[model samples]
Target: MKRSIALLALLLWLSTVALVHAQTLPSVKPEQVGLSSERLGRLVSMLRNDSEKGQIPGAILLVARQGKIALFESVGVLDPKSKAPMTKDAIFRIYSMSKPITSVAIMTLVEDGKIALGDPVAKYIPQVAEMQVGVEKPGADGKPTLELVAPRRPMSLQDLLRHTSGLTYGIFGNTLVKKQYLDAKLFVGDPTNAEFVDRLVKLPLASQPGTMWDYSHSTDVLGRIVEIVTNKSLYEFEKERILDPLGMKDTAFDVTDKAKQARIAEPFPNDVTIGTDTTFFDPRVPQRWQSGGGGMVGTVMDYARFCQMLLNGGTLDGKRILGPKTVAYMTADHLDGSVAPGPLYLPGVGFGFGLGFAVRREAGVANVQGSTGEFNWGGAGGTFFWVDPKEDLFVVYAMQSPKQRVYYRPVLKNMIYSAVVKPNGK
Candidate 1:
């Protein structure tokens, strides 16, 4: 009886050590990890349903927990035009999702003492120091024209990160400032970063520096700031500082290889969006305009690696990109209650704007089910990812249907959370 008891105890000790020594991001069954295999099947089924109905062209979904991959799926088509199969390694246009990367790049520079969040925009971009804000006024031709007013304060790097700067995306609305953006073609085609910034400064501010939140060209401006401080193009700096270090080999400002061009994802032929038509970039040919805000093409596995790094507190596979405190600072809410709400996107109710992400202030604010401290951002194209630090979880979805993106982000967020089952029923 004593010998039998000792053998059982030894077996228990071996099991404990196996759990403790788990690898980071190792592919595992959902049940073996902390997720529900049955429920994960349900999540993938929804993707199939959406694709079958022609709601979404195609997508890639990845979920990681406790540093292990629980789910990775490739569904739908690679090219809607050609009906090619969507592979796990197919490239996608991760539009606004690029902002998070640019934001990280800025904070990495801050970590190096090369820059600070509180620095004035004019300090680096001189044209912004004395820029005037625009107020619409009635004109002699029965049309409204912009009347210039001095800004209450100078725009800062922090404001740019939070989208509180008086900038506007021409695609969002028909405001006079947006018209100015349209007039100048601030982000049109192959203009170099310098030319883009020069053309951008010629426009008037959409709002006071810190008064309102407009989803404008602020991130592209932030990208330019990164270029200015590093003395390298935004693409080059990103490759050295973040992408290469993280082993995100397939992520880049442009895909120049002839072979990779065949893997590029394409949107539907007609404009099916409600407000405005999106401009799709052709990766086969390179353009000089590197939109740090929206110009990036990457694979599903590559972006999942990026998300895992952020979930691991700025380190992934032994790489330390940003320190823990810096990640905390970047994801923390910068827009307190004092500032009026900006664009209503994530955490629909109890959420705030962070340096680089939309943070969840409470669990029940949004239509979806998620824990507090849940920060996420999505692309105009149907690509979204969320990191829940409380649960050590992050999920990434990549697709290319701009019109259906609005429907998919919340839908996927809710489905992924519903799939979670407590370990040992704890």
Candidate 2:
């Protein structure tokens, strides 16, 4: 009896050990993956000091490489009033960071033959059918002005993905199209299918489709098209196609559970040189519009899974979401060597709008030292993410505060470069 009892006890011990091992992340050590915990700590300290100095409320960051997650850290209070310190599981308004995820979902549909990239958007969403373009201004004397007319070439799904669909943001500086968008009450409140289509259709194009690269509501329009193509709401399609498949349980368009709301970090305000006084976090409440462009909440781990899937050539844990070629095409710059004028935030950058994020220009220009063929983009808030194929690396950073004041990516790049394995792969 004593011998039997001892054997049972040993079995229990082994089970506990296995449970611990399973719960632990894959063995991607920081040093092995070329990361310095010391540098990471300093980065956290900087964020905390910034919060204490009233620069931001909080921040969260994660670093992963070679199918392993190394660092997941958070700094500052999730809620300043309650003083709840941020945790790894703390939720954040990912903002434009949601774009890439949504884009991935769209591409998954593409892989399934649900839609084609070059197919005219009007083929699915009738709203874009017969879409018009802007031309010359009317004369003050009510006579004909120099009318610049052109064929209304059908805007393709590729155009929507590339922001070449001639759509413009209503909030972007005061312009003629901006005025039209405002007057149409577009992007004013929680957008609906009919309301969004009506307002967007009435607004004239900023430029002819495929003629310019203007950062606009093309993603939101793409979201609507996804609904038409899939016969499911954008929210439903994302849940069915991407989130559930990847075990992204915490990510969603809306906070459905009360417990999740407690974890949802507050969106802090910042100095915005453009648009109205409205900030992302109105004292800890989520925004009304379930905007596809930038309206989802997620944790670092959840987002890392999405990025990891991309880094793994569109498969994670044997679940193939995109073809390897599709992943490569998405990361490759697609702007045909057309340089964006002015001091764009990403210097030496070229546009390659695929499913949702910007593809990197090349191994040259506007890249971190270790960023070889890396593709990345960020949110209006401090949230940023990148996938470095050359290193099989994935990274995500999040913070509350709706302004483009901080340049966190470069700092992160420097930190990453410090940890690159020596020539012999360390």
Candidate 3:
């Protein structure tokens, strides 16, 4: 009788503990996630006051947890000139955010044995075989000019993904290769694959393959490489492989539908002096360069679906876009000690360039409250996403700021961490 009573008491304690855990999940309605409703009103008021002072023209913010879209908020006007209010479903030009999706497309091909990480880029695009490295010199005008020289090593598909192939962005920072990339008009206009290939061959690399980390148009080059290997245009390959399977209905390189254009948010600059100039670039035009680096528009909820898919190990609902192992490979660190000679833009961060996104190995610099295994990537405009497996959490923030300063990672992460409970209901 004494032993029976002891066993029953132990079982009761375990049940009580589980019940408490369910109650302490930190889950709440969307409005409750931020400061209270009164505080949120204050936040909106502050945002408006700042906008009038030319701090920012408009903004949209959302926070979701465990598939529950608990908060969706917008402030200021979509267009300062037109005085249009931002909407929850506003579309934005998601620049480098497009890289992660394109990287997914490439990995799909990898899963099918269509390509390998170690494959030479020249194997698919012959013009790349003749590529050279740029050496700085002065022209007759005494201004800087680039001369073509042989590369120390060949650039591989893996090098392109990791930004170690010495291919520098012409606009990233002023350098000899930057001038050359601009002079060659590498990505300025629409061009056939053959034309793009010819221009890329003539351009010189900035460094030897696998030597350094520089954000360049390498993903854009990957777009062309995909066409060569798959024998299909970049859009066609992405559509059949990723978009259709994942049900990302609103995402595309160009906006052809009038209705869709109506919902596309105008890009805003973080600097009030510039604001948003609507008279600038038009997204409706079909261009020759489908930049894998920074070329695509997506809605807020649609992008959330993409994040959720990644959170679930490359599957959404019953559809699987990639193998779980592929997802792991893509998010793992590929950096070597010799690469990235400069201080990292993000402090206490070790680089992990999988197919596209950067994974955070060091937590202190990321200043993120998520798991050490978390990885994320954002756009030029104020768009961001981070996934934490330890917390089973995912967060995305979308804004169309031109200056690229609004979507802060640290503060936003702090807010999310405040709501995350320890596994045992601590």
Using Cα atoms with residue i matched to residue i, what is each candidate's TM-score against the true structure? 0.90, 0.85, 0.82
Best by TM-score: 1
In candidate 1 the C-alpha lDDT for residue 80 amounts to 84
Tens-place lDDT per residue, model 2, 1-426, is: 999999999999999885554333475567776666676667667777887886777878777776777777788888776888888788877777877877787788888898888898778767676556666577899754444344368888887777778777766656555566667767677667546766787667777777666777788877777777788778788888777766677787767677777887765433433354335633144444556776777887788888888888887666677899988877765555442332122323533544566666555565455454677777776678888787777778887666633466677667765655543134
lDDT of 1 by residue, 323-395 (tens): 9898998888887655766554343577777987989888775777888888888887778888889888888
lDDT of 3 by residue, 13-44 (tens): 99888555422223467443332444434555
Q: Candidate 2: lDDT of 252?
A: 77
Global lDDT of model 2? 0.70
Query: What's the residue-level lDDT of 353 in candidate 2?
Result: 48
| Alpha-carbon local distance difference test for all models | 0.82, 0.70, 0.70
Candidate 1 whole-model C-alpha lDDT, 0 to 1: 0.82
- Name the TM-score of candidate 3: 0.82
At residue 58, candidate 3 shows an lDDT of 65
Clashing pairs in 3: 30-70, 190-288, 268-401, 268-402, 269-402, 270-403, 347-365
